[model samples]
Structure formats: C-alpha cells, structure tokens
Target chain A: MEKHRSAPTLDDVAKMADVSTATVSRCLNSPDRVVEATRKRVLTAIETLGYTPNFAARVMAVKRSFTIGAIIPTMENAIFARGLQSFQEELHQRGYTLLVSSSAYKPEIEEEQIRTLIARGADGLLLIGHDRDPKIYDFLSQRKIPALVAWSYLPDSKLPSIGFDNRAAMFDLASHVIGLGHTQIGVISGLVDGNDRARLRVQGIRDAVSSSGLEAGNLTLVETSYEIENGAKAFRDLMNADPPPTAILCGNDVLAAGALRQAQEMGLDVPGHVSITGFDDIELARIVSPALTTVHVPHREMGRKAALQLVEMVENQTAGTGEQLSTRIVNRPSLGKPALG
Target chain B: MEKHRSAPTLDDVAKMADVSTATVSRCLNSPDRVVEATRKRVLTAIETLGYTPNFAARVMAVKRSFTIGAIIPTMENAIFARGLQSFQEELHQRGYTLLVSSSAYKPEIEEEQIRTLIARGADGLLLIGHDRDPKIYDFLSQRKIPALVAWSYLPDSKLPSIGFDNRAAMFDLASHVIGLGHTQIGVISGLVDGNDRARLRVQGIRDAVSSSGLEAGNLTLVETSYEIENGAKAFRDLMNADPPPTAILCGNDVLAAGALRQAQEMGLDVPGHVSITGFDDIELARIVSPALTTVHVPHREMGRKAALQLVEMVENQTAGTGEQLSTRIVNRPSLGKPALG
Candidate 1:
C-alpha cells in the first residue's frame, strides 16, 4: 500500500511564510485585519502549500458551520422537491451548504437525525411540520441550536415556522368543491398519525363538508401512505361504497393525480361524472388531465424564508421563536359542478 | 446580549472526571483501550457535561470524517430524489452522514461543491454523471478522495460508475415502438449538452429509427429543459406539424406525463391519435392515465452499489475502476399498435 499522506496545516503555512501563527490565522480568518503585504505572503504560502483550513477548526473558531441541516419526511415524490431545491439555492447564495436527511415519515428517525445534525455541528436546522415530541424541542433549546419548521404553519406553535396554513388552505379548496353541489365526498388522505399537515388538511375538508349542511357521516375517508398506487387503491375502494361520492378530495396532488387516473381507468368522466380536488398544487396537478383544482402553497417562498430565517438565527444567534406564512386556493378545471342527482 | 456558551472539549471532560487528558481522549475515541471502570466514569462525565465529540478534531486524529458528499444537477423534481434517498439510507446504515448539494445543472457550481466537500474532509464523494472536466478528476486524485459516478453507465469510462446503460435501455424501448409500426415519431428530449445520459438516450432512439429503414429526418426532435411546462409546449409544437407523428417519445416520465395531458386536452386519444412513451419509469409513469411505457432503470440497486463502492474505497483504500448495471423496458398500457392507416 502507498504511504498515507497528511493534509497541509496552518502551522506549516505559517512556517513557510515566516510569520507568527496568529498572523497566519488572522490572514485566513479575517484578511481585513492583516496588512496587505503580509496577507499576500500568507495567501501565497497557503496556495503553494495547498493548505486548506479544516472546516471543523474554522467552525470552532468562528462558532459557525456555514451549514444548515434539514430533516424532511420523504423524498420519493416531487411534493417537497421543488421547495427544497429553492431552499438550497437560497442557502448557497447566503454562503451556506444545505445538508438534508429524510426521516422516512418516522418521528423516531427524525429525532435521531436531529441528534446527528447537532453532533455534526450544524449551525442551524430546518425541520418539516410543527409536530414532534416536546423532548426534541427541549433538547434543541437546551443545546441552543436554532431550528425552523416548514411545510405547515401554526400561529400558536413555539418554533419559528415558515409555511402555509394547511387547514385554512384546504378548507378554502374544499369549500369550492362543496359549492359545486358535491354532498357525497370521498377522501383519500395521507396517513396522518404523525403528520400534522396531513391531519389538518383532512380536517379542513371535513369542516367544509359539515358546514355545507351535510352530515359528517356523508363523507367517507380512506387513510393510506403517500403513494400513487395507494391513492388509486383507496379511490377504487371508496367508489365501491353503497353511495359513491360525486367528488373526491385528496390531501395533496400526488393522491389527487392517482385518483384522477384511477377514475379515468374505471371509465368515469372527470367533472362530468366526478370532480376531484387536491392541495399543495404540485406540478402534477397542472400536468394531469383536466388540471387539478388545488391549494397552491407558496413553496418556493416558504423555502426561501426558511433558509433565511435559519441562517439569521445561526449567524446572529437571534432567537427564531415565531414566524408564519400564508396559503391560498388555485381554482383549476378539475373542480366543477357535480353531476345532476 | 445572551451569554455565549462553548462546546466542551476532551480536556474539559478530563478535568471534570479527574482523569488524564489522554485517558479522556481514549475513552471517547477508543473506549476498548481504556479500563471499563474508567471508561464508564469518563462517559458519565461527558454526558453530564453535554460534550459531543469535536468532529474536526476527530477527523485530524483518526483521518476519518464518517461523512459522504453527493452533488447532483437538480432537486426540483423526482429526477434524482428516489435514488439519492436510497443512497443516503445506505450511507446511514454504514454509520455515515450524506451531505448533498445541487448544482442546478452547472459544471462550475459542481466543481465548487466538490472543493467544499473536500475542504470539509468528506471521506468519499458520489457524483451524478461523468461529464466533469479532467481538472476535477485531478483534484480528487490529488486528495486521494474515493469518488463514484451514478445515474449513467459507461462500460469503459475512466470513473467507476454504478448506473444503468442509458443508450441500450432507450434503444430497446424505441425498438418496441418501431415494431408497433409507428413510422413517424416525435421526440421530446432533455437538453443534452452537459447531460450524457440524455444525449445517449436520444442517440439510441435515432439508431433504432435509422436501422428500421425509417428516415431519421422524419423523426421530429425538440430539445428542452427537464420540466413539465417545457414538455407541454414541445408537444404543442410537435402536434402542429403539417403531418404530426403518430407517436411521441419523451426522455423521461415527467415530460411524457406533460405530453399525455396536453394530448388529452387537445381532444386526441393516446395510443389512438398518437402513442406516447417515457423513460425512467418513475412512479408517475405507472400512475398517469394510460400508464406510460418506459425503460426501468434500477435506481435503488444503483444507489446501494454506489454507496457500497464508495465506502469500500474509503475504508479499504481499494481502487474502483469501472462497473455497470442493466436496464430494461417496462411495457405498460401506454404503448399499443399504431392506429391503422
């Protein structure tokens, strides 16, 4: 085996430049503090020696990683992809690297990831949704680690949240469907046990149905994982009920797209036979047939805000206690008047 | 201003535990080398002090970061999301943290990210494809960083790539379309300049068309970015031809999904007025109406292999030269016999 090599260190560069170690460190850490001639000599020595400042050492001195860690539920779909891309870009512009990890929708995994990021010395953290064990929050607080939540917003939440109002956003979209004379509504929702976003969105639809003078029992609900096939299966089962719904409202575009395709496969004409709606108006909503009517969360804006807020907290040690974003409905062709009784 | 707190060091833990500094370091770095009784006492002191190991100091001492870095083109869609998720999981299982950065399809940004990862002392790197400048290879070689390429496979490429054959996979799918007697085919390809996989896939389709005695010029081609909106606009342009092709082939399912929806909106029956096929066979392909017929790349397998190869190269200092995975066509409901002339 070839002999192992060592990386050039600050001491080597300082020795090569014939400067005090403090001068070399100051040149690298705060060039403005060093004389131009001395800084030039230090830089040349650094370049010639190929001395790269160890990130951990630099982070230790500055008390910042210039890194932000985000933990989300999953990345198997495009739901969070667009927003996250924007988030990362924003961080890049702010001179930070975005480190992301998926929790596979498990709270335990998310907790573990939080600990890992902290261990890795992330200056700030971006969490998805405002739901987690209180112990996690206490741990973060005790450690003084700045954390921001995205994807769903709660004004009453303790953490700084940069996301849309899930319940109100869904309620607005569902009201439109209810106004279209859809009394019988079947719902295909993402499993919501640990996801406040999914749960709140489902409740928003239920509230809309009840407020429209329809009995709560008139609405049928099927809970499934966030997969297109699962959505299709749930839609098929819902249609087999004694009284099929005139419209199907899904928790998100992924499920809505699936239900729409499954309805087409079953020979049902959308809107003409059954209307379908979704939330989070991802690209799929517009790319699907008839174009889905859904709530358009300002995903890019949310991402940008989350990145900025987290960075601010990390850099300035400013407490990020409360921040909220808004959401609205995007009325597309998928929702229309229900077929006559 | 709030009082600033500092992370506890090995010396701090040693002072608190009434143990030698070497003993504290050994207790944290190589607990087995220390007496069990002393190790327990040191660990308890560390826990009480809330002392997490300094990652940088550990890297300097052990020459290991236990971290891997990956740089990809984009994260705005499911393009690299699923495969990357699997790759990160594999890294986690092996006790490593995966740090990912997106270059937005720019080579310069990718180079910057590579240098950043190296500066951060990443043990290994996972790159998207084999299109970077030779200087990058030199930098990795100089640093002795074990790097692996993914998403596209080239049997004789200089890099060790754990990906599927993009060209042959698309060729097989194109041959299936040709066998269906579709004389004229419209191609919606991703911008292929910096993307070897997209370029090769397009070449494969052209090869199949030429070999089948079909005039390659008769195949209409529209190059666009990988976006649903671009796919819709491209489909519109293709359909407006004096003699629109009887079939449309898209570089990926996101594009194909857009084309299918546009065709439906234009009141044309898919596989009736025109057949549509996609690549990558992502979940969207199966979820879309008509079920896109496309090539299935072994995404998870490739991800796992890439992780394993990179880890091996890092841990065992093994040199990985070249490797390739297989791809196959998935015959779904989208493709059917061309409409009778």
Candidate 2:
C-alpha cells in the first residue's frame, strides 16, 4: 500500500518506456499511428507501471465519454430488469458503458438524475416513458444531449421512443375480455398521476366498456402503487362491491400476482369466482397459479432497438425517428368464461 | 438548433454576467467565496445559457466525483433489486449519486466494470460479494479506492462487507428440513463456480446431511443458472432418480417457485407426495401457491447499513468495519414431513 502512494502518471509511463510524452499520448489515442513494436513497448510500460489512462483528460480531448446513462422508474421488481439487461448487453457490444440510476417513480428524482448523469459526462441517455415535464425536453435540447425514451410510445411527443402503445395494447386486451360474455369488469390500475401507461390502460378498458354498449359507470376502478400487496388490497375492495365484477384486469403482473393471492385467501377460485388478467408477460405472470393471461410486449426487442437507435442518435446528431412496436394478448387459464348464473 | 450549434463556454457566462472568468469559476465551484448579488447574476446567466459545468474538469480540480459505483451480479431477477433500491435511496439522501452496472453473473464483466467505474472517477464502490480475483482487490488497493462488499458476508475477507452469512442461514434452514423427519433430500442450487454464496449454500446442505447421519450420496444436488426454467429442469432431473428424494430444497424462492410449478404439472401434491423448501424469501415466495417455507433475509437493513458504512469510508477515508446480519427461517405450507412409506 505504501509503495503505491500515488497513482503513476503518463509521464511515469513515458519515463519507464524511455519515450517522449507525445509518443505515449499518440500510442494511447491513435494506436494505428504508431509502429507496432514501439506501441508494444509503451503498452508494456503502462502495464508494468499500472498507469490508467486519464479518463477526464481523454473526455476533454475527444469531447465524448463513450458512456450512456439510463434512468428507470424503480428497481424494486423485475419489470425493467429484463429489458435493461438487453439494453446494457447491446450497448456493451457497441463499445459503450451503461450507467443506471432508479428514480423510484418520482418525477423530481428523475429530473435530478438527468442533470446528474449529464454532470457526470454521459454522452447520451436512455429515459423511460415519454411523459415528463416539457422543460426537461427543453433542457436536453438546449444542451444538445440526445435522449431516447422507452416503455411507452408517443409518436408526436417531443422525444423519440422505441416502444409499444400502452393504450392500444390494453384496448385489445379489454376487447377480448369483453368478448368473453362478461358485462361487469373491474380494473386494478397503477397510480395514473405521473404514469401515462397506467392512465392509458384504464382508458382502454373504459373504451372497451363503452364500445360494448355497457354503462361506463358500472366499471369498478381502483388505482394504487404497483405492488403485490397493493394488488391484493385493491382486489378486496373491488370484490366487496354489492355485486362483484366477473373479471379484474391488473395494470401489470406484480399487481395481478397479489390479486391472485388475495383471491385464494378469500377462498374464491380464480376464473371460477372471478377472472383476472394482467399486462406484461413477465416471469411472474406465469409463475402465479392459473398462469396469468396477459399482454406480451416485446421487452427484449424494445431494449435492443432502443440501444441501437440511441447510439446512432448520439453518434450522428440526428433527431431519431420513433418506431412503434406491437403487443399481443397471451391466453391462459386465468381468463375464462364467467361462472354460469 | 443552428443558433445553439456550439455549447456556451465559461467565457460566455462571464461576459453575460459582467464578471471576470475567475469570479465565474469561484461562483461555480465555491459560491461562498463570491458575493450573493454577483453570484445570482452569474447563476441566472448560467441557467439562460444552459452551461453544464464540465464534470471532467471539476473532478480533476477537486480529486473527487461524489459518485459511488455499484456492480451487481444480475438485474434479470428480483434477487438483488430490493436491496439495491434501498442502497440507492440512502445514497441519494447523502448528496451522493449512485451509478450501477450489472455483470450478468459474469466475473470478466465485473472486472471490466470495476475499471470503467474507476476510470470514470467513482469516489468509492459497492461490490455485491467478496469473492473475485485477488488481483482485482490489489488493483483497487493500488488505486486507493474504497470498496465495500454487500449481499454475502465473509468476516476474514480483504474487503469489508455488511451482509448476512449465506452458510449459516442455509444451514439453519437445512437443519429445520432434516428435523422434519426427511431421510432423502434433493438440492436445486445456483452454479457455484464464480459465486461464493452459491458454493457456501451447497456446502451448508451437505453439512446438514452429514450431521443428521444420512449418507451424503443420498442427498442429490443439481446446479444450474438462477432462472425459473432451469429450476424446473433441475427438478425434473432430480425426480428422475430411482426412489426419488422425499424433499427438494431450492437455492432461492425463484427456483422453488419453478419446482413447485413443475410438481403441479407432474401431478404431485406438495408436502404430500414430496415436501419442498426455498431460501431468500422474496415476494415471489408468498405469491406462489401453498406459499414457500424459506429463509427470510434482512435485505433492506443490509442495504441501508451498507450505504451508511460505505459513505463513511469514502468521506472519512477510514477502513470500514464489516457487519454480519442475521436471517430467520419462515415456515410456510411448502415444507412438511415425508409421506409414510
């Protein structure tokens, strides 16, 4: 520990390799410009001295850090894990490092993280969802920072996104549920205050309700944070109505798993006493008993494409085009015909 | 976009605010050194110009980034999510930013990420486990960077950690299983090659089998990556044995959930035809049918403590003390006595 009191500088490497500092710098920045034998000597000296090329100096010289930052809602569940993994893997293949930070579903925290990432020299950013303060877009624009949004697609939004339409996907799922000979329906939705996905999903169900010539007032709606326990509580509240709805649709799989558990605790058989559905075919969707019927968004495709497009935008300074992905409903045991009267 | 083609420099802020470059620099770096009236003018100019202070220059001048980097094995599941969320929350309250990267359970990736984080000027690091190449520890030591380990505790390790003992926790759970009058046991474990936690857990079960006077050969073990499908496959492999083990102990709840699902598919009644158990009672444990008998870890506590200790090490330049957190066995319907022969 005493021997390595100070980090060896570029000068130390130059001295060790018996070369000028210019030669060391050239070898590091443009290896092809230097002869192989001379570059080898400099590299060997660098390794022996354990000298790390100064990242700060390099960033200043090249005006690019080759680091991309991603800000997600929460890391408390597996919802964003799979997609983020694919995104990171894709970025790594492209020679970019990914730095991730979770905002815990708070707009203020997300805003702060955006600034933090920028302050930390991120060349580009991957933001989740298109719903945020417009000033944030102005901030990024003023700084010429390229940011790409994922998870929810809004074609005409100020930002470019590679994602699926939450509203239309849920509309399709709701239409299927309504077609299954069920008139009464309930919804367990995530808080819609800041989440466009949850709000659009609820609207989709409402659209299905009205399209089927049913009274919109008859649909029971409960909004809560996305959690298993919250799902169970919302399920209870929906069931306690004078006449419980025949089917319940959850905003995501985590909430659906909770609803399933609460139904078991209540001794009510799923799809027998009530049918339940969820969006996002995460592993939790299938692991639950009766296996959740869900809307399968192409998570990996969105992640991989988002990475590819964001990197291109960063490198080429283009206002990248937004591409909309499609989703399909997964039919499973959790959804069935309402019990015979 | 054409008007703002180039970024506004410090000179631009100085000219706009009618202050010298030194005053503008002082206002940005140490506001107390400047007058409030002048500081406000400079700040307003900065906001109008959207001048982001160069992070690289600041890091070089101050020799600190106030950013902590954490590398986890995988973000593909909820195993580490809960704890990481807590860790990030705590770091936020301390005025420090957290940058995270996932290794996808690959050691080489973890090693590369360590270098990346250091190069990008992380003031400190939070590593998931103590197991890694010894040279990596030497590298960190040579750079004089403080790194704290979390998730798995090893008291004698070179690095300090705030985590629970995987071996003791699993041994307690295994002992409880053996006491339930089970003579034959099956273990579904995560691959132990690069993971100390997985290796320790398998060893704990082996110790429990021997302590109970059962032939070690009777305790069948199948190792696979941590995934639900792998767990199901491993379960099938274990059950194919002649006179299959009466009980199956999964490394974690995710695996246990898969095994339980497969058992249902195979038409085997849990705790009736064969008892099953799990470890690390994540939310999935209770969400599964029959619930899961598993070990409950203090995930949030460990995360919060890890943050507090790591921050102290970074801020005060102290060698932080390691802490061992305790875990308990949570009895659920999944584990029971072997059916009478």
Candidate 3:
C-alpha cells in the first residue's frame, strides 16, 4: 500500500460507505448490534481505506481496554522473571493482555511509566513496591485506576499487596545461620532507600543478630545494587576486614551467588572458611556451586495470586486485600559450622 | 471522587464545561491550539469528571503515538535484558515510550502480541530474530508499520536488522577450539526449529569443522531450549556417549553455565577434563565458576544502534538497512587442551 498523506479517519470511511460515523463505531465495537448489510458495507469501506478503530476512543466509549500494566524494578536479573512470567500467563488465561515496563530500580522512572500506562488506558496497574510517594496513590485514586502491589506484602498497606513478608523470611534465614554456630556475621544487602523489602531484610538481619546475643552494630553491613559484580566487590571488602565474619548473609540469591563466586576466586572454601547464605530461593540458588542456603519465596504462587486478585478487583470493582504468603528456609551446603580462626 | 455509574465520555466533559465536543477534543489533543481561559475551563472539567482521552481516536487524528513495541522471545534469562535496556534508553532519548511483550518463543503468541501492540497504536515494532510467518509481515506491511529485526543481522535481508552474524561468530569460536587441538567436540544449542540465530550458530560450527579438515558428522549435536536445566540435561546425555567429546560448545552463556554446573556435579574439572565454550558474553559467562570462554556480543551497542535505526525508519518512512557488528572470543579458563587418551 502506498503511504497515505494522512491516516484514514472515521469521517473518510463514513463518507466512502455513505454511513454515519456512529454506524462505523458500532460496526467496529459492537458488530452484532448493526444490520448485516450495513456492517458488510462499513467493513468493505474500512478495508478499502484501512481505517483502524482508535484505541483511546474505544476505551473511552467502552470503559475497558482489557489490558493490565505492570511496572517492575529491574529486568537485569532472573529474580522477578519467573514470578512475572506466571503473572502474565494468568492474566492471559483470564482474557487480558499485559503491558510490562521496567524502571531499572528508579522510583522517578517508575512514576513516569505508571502515568504512561494510565494514559494508555490500562484497565489496572501492578506495582512492584509500595514505597512510592503518596501523591502517586492520590493520582491513581483521582483517576479511579485500580493498582495491585506485588513482591512486598504489607497487611496494613493502603494498596492491595500480594507477597511474602521480606523481613520475616530474612529473619528466619539469618536465625538458621546463627543456629549453625556462626558467631561473627556480615551482611550484603540491596540498596534500602525507598525499598521496603531491602530495609525490611536488613532489619531482619539486625533482629537476628540481637537475638543471638550479639550487638547488631557488631555485624559488618555492606549495601550495594543487585548485581553480580557489585556483590563481588562487597564480598571482597567484607573479607579484607581485620577479622572477617565467618558467615555472610546476602540479601538475595543473586548477591549470594556473587559472594560465592568471589569466595571461590579468592581460594576460600565455602562453609569451611566462610559460610554464605541467601534469601529468595530462585534458580540461581541451586545453580551456584555448593548450592545456596536460602529462604524460598513462592514466586509462582505470588505471581498467580497477584494476577487473579488484580483481575478480580478490576472486573468486580471491589477493594483489594493483601494476601501474605510464607517462605521456608532451604538448607544447602553453602552454610555450615564456621571454621576455627 | 465517588465511583461513577459509567465512565465520563468526551460529551460528558463538553457538557460539564459548557463547550462543544470538538472544543474538548482540541483542548486535550492540542492545548497550545486553544486559548488559556478555555483550556483552563476544559482542564478543570476533565479533572472533576475524570475524563480520559481515547487512545485510538488520538492515533487516527494525529497519526503519531511516540510509542514503540518490542516482542522478544524470552525474558527468563539476562540474555536480552541488557540489550533491551539500552534500546529503551535510546527510545526515551528520542521522546518515545517502549512497550515490551515476551512471546515465550511461540510464533502464535508473537503474532497475537504483534496485533495487540499494533491495535494499541505502536508507531513501530522491534522484533527479535527473523523467523516469523510471512503473513505477519504482510499484516504489518498493510498497516504501514515500520518493523526492525535485531540480534541476527543479515547483509541482504528484506527486514532491517542490527546485530552481529550469529553463524560467523559461532564458527570463529569453533575454529578457535579446533586450533586449541580440540578434535572431538559436542554441541549444546538452543532449539533451532524456528530460531535463525540458533540454526545459524550450529551451521557455523559445522562450517568450521569442515574447513579445519574434520568431519562435520563427527561433531555430536544436541538441541534443546535456551535454559540452564535443559543445557545440563543435554550435557549429561552427550557425556553418556560411547566416548564423550573433549570440548563442548553452547549456543549461549546460559547454556554454558548449566553445562559447567553439571560438570562440577559430575566431578569433572572444567577446562581440565573437558573444555566448554559459549556464545553471548552475558554476565553469567563471568559469574560462573572458572569463568566461561564465550563470544562477546556487543549487546549495548547493538541495542543503541537498533533504536537509532528503527526510529529513523519510523519517522522518515525510509526502507531500513541491516548493520552487522563483530564478535570476539573472550578467553576465560573454560577452554583448555583435550587430554591425551
């Protein structure tokens, strides 16, 4: 087809078919409502002129796009891959298309993406964390857009959230390491600013340290982005300390994997010289050498539940509620008795 | 605001603002085209009534959405993550929003997603690989949507592609292995049925074998999905052969990481017992134990270039051209001399 000087409009199609614009709209949106002969005529005109129904106008007329938008933190790691995969699959099963945007862990970018999705007539939105500015919630409320928060669950949250308690899960993992006769400890955590999950995980480690009859301040804590190279640098800094902690608790499996790799490269025997533990029993946990001792969050279940609950809220126009899932510790060879100094 | 009985349409906004429907549309679409006082009254009404502009109608009116859609095979791994991240950044710089859909490597799903994105008014599309039904191309052509293929560049391709030659890259890696005295080689590749990248890579290895005075038939090939677990399973099956190859080459780093993990589990030393090489120098290549000898793909460069080229095609309405980058073998400790039998 030759390039059109301008796109075919409803008026052009209406003029060609000798029908009103309303008739064209009805033929496109509700074909069964129109007469068969009129519908055929309109369809023929639309084909001849290549008239596509305007997405925004259709959404405005019908008040539905059957599209759900999700804004995630980062796609650079497999941490959220499996869960988000399940979330979209469930959405598809319920006859909804999903639009995903990655924010690269930047809150400002996420806000822009959220606004962009809303402007695209997204039926509802899925946000990764509940730590954004309250103004965003106000905007969503004013726009009457239903949003579901995933990856971090807060029972008293103003928004509906479906996830495991990050603090409690990390606490359990840290306590298990404590029970394994590890006295000194080090922690490598994700950046905590505006991240409730990271902050809560760090708090969990502190609670575990205090409960184990050690000063929380005694633990060496290093904060870094969720990357393998960053995790390696953090691990090295923690190891070069005057007296290194016998056990290192990583914020997630990716960080823990990084620490394990660093340990291997430095000729250190894991669980023999320095024990390393992780949270989030993603595939990375099992793939790393010696495996990883981690807290297993039910990623698939969380994703599926988020999708079902968000769809229910959008379709039924009901207030969403938080559903807290449980995480269990998966003991692997990565953590064991600390070696004598 | 209380929940509305029905969505506020353009007519509702016009009636509330005491203006005509055309005036309301003009105010929303082109505020500069409207006077300040009139724009103010329309904006207030829109806020009070929560009126959303129709997406489809706007596209038909302006013929521009400033939105680009990409359909990638999978996001379960970091293989496409870095490249796509760069692409989005470049698009953002060009004042465009990116909408991404994962096809899960299914052609039907990809086609459906393509239609959905197009219906949503994507100004252009970025698709991975060149293997898709010709009908999809015809559909895009009919719609006059500018489409770009990436991750597999062909000099004489009908579609514009920005990527390195997958086959040539793999062939060079294979020839390098042959030069290292690795006569017996095993292949663990991504499923090549509808993936030109994977098929071309396998062919590249065959080319190297024949050119090096070795029988291409002697290279044991096992095809599976681009998954770590699948790679491990394929590695084990290949090792169970009458006499296993001393060198194993994987289509991507994810597969090679799996092979290395399996080798460690099977009590085989990497590069010492058997050399394993991989394509795609993703982070997994370096993070894996012993590191991976893999071909370094210019992920960020390809992503940036694809964005620049696709935007040029969409805005200029120009027939796009393919740009091929080069790949280099990153020598880590994964490959070594074959043991003397």
Best by DockQ: 2
Better of 1 and 2 by lDDT: 2
| lDDT tens per residue, model 1, A30-61 | 45678899999998998798776666555644
lDDT of each: 0.82, 0.87, 0.86
lDDT of 2 by residue, A1-341 (tens): 45635777878888888988778766664456789999999989987988876675556445566689999998888899889999998887776778899998999789878877888778899998877898899999977899999999998988898889898999999999999988889999999988888898998999888988989876999999999999999999999986899999999999999999999999999999999999999999999998999999898999999999998998899999979999999999999999987
lDDT of 1 at A32: 60
Q: Per-residue CA lDDT of candidate 1, range B1-341, in tens?
A: 88867777867788888998767766654455788889889989977887766665556445676778899888777878778888977876776767777788988778767866776667899998888788678778877899989988787766788887888888888888999899889999998998898999899999999988899777999999888878888999999996898889999998998898888879888888998999987887877777899888888888888888898999899988657788888888788888888
Worst 10 residues of 2 chain A by lDDT: A54-63
Residue B295 in model 1: shift from native, Å?
1.0
Lowest lDDT 10-mer window, candidate 3 chain A? A53-62
Model 3 regions more than 4 Å off: A1-62, B1-63
Regions of model 2 farther than 4 Å from truth:
A1-46, A60-62, B1-53, B56-63
Candidate 2 lDDT over B1-341, as tens digits, reads: 45736778777888999988777766654466678999999989988988776665455445566678999998888998889888988887776778899998888779778877887778899998777998899999988899999989988999998988898888888888899888889999999998888899999999888888989878999999999999889989999998798999999988899999999999999989888888888998988887999999888988889889998998799999989999999999999999988
Model 3 lDDT tens row, A84-157: 89998888777677888888888867876776687677889999878988878888997779999998999888
In the order shown, the candidates' DockQ scores are 0.48, 0.66, 0.43
DockQ of candidate 3 against the true complex: 0.43
- Deviation from native of the Cα of residue A320 in model 3, angstroms: 2.0
Off by over 4 Å in 1: A1-53, A60-63, B1-49, B57-63, B240-243, B336-341
> Candidate 1 has which clashing residue pairs, if any?
none
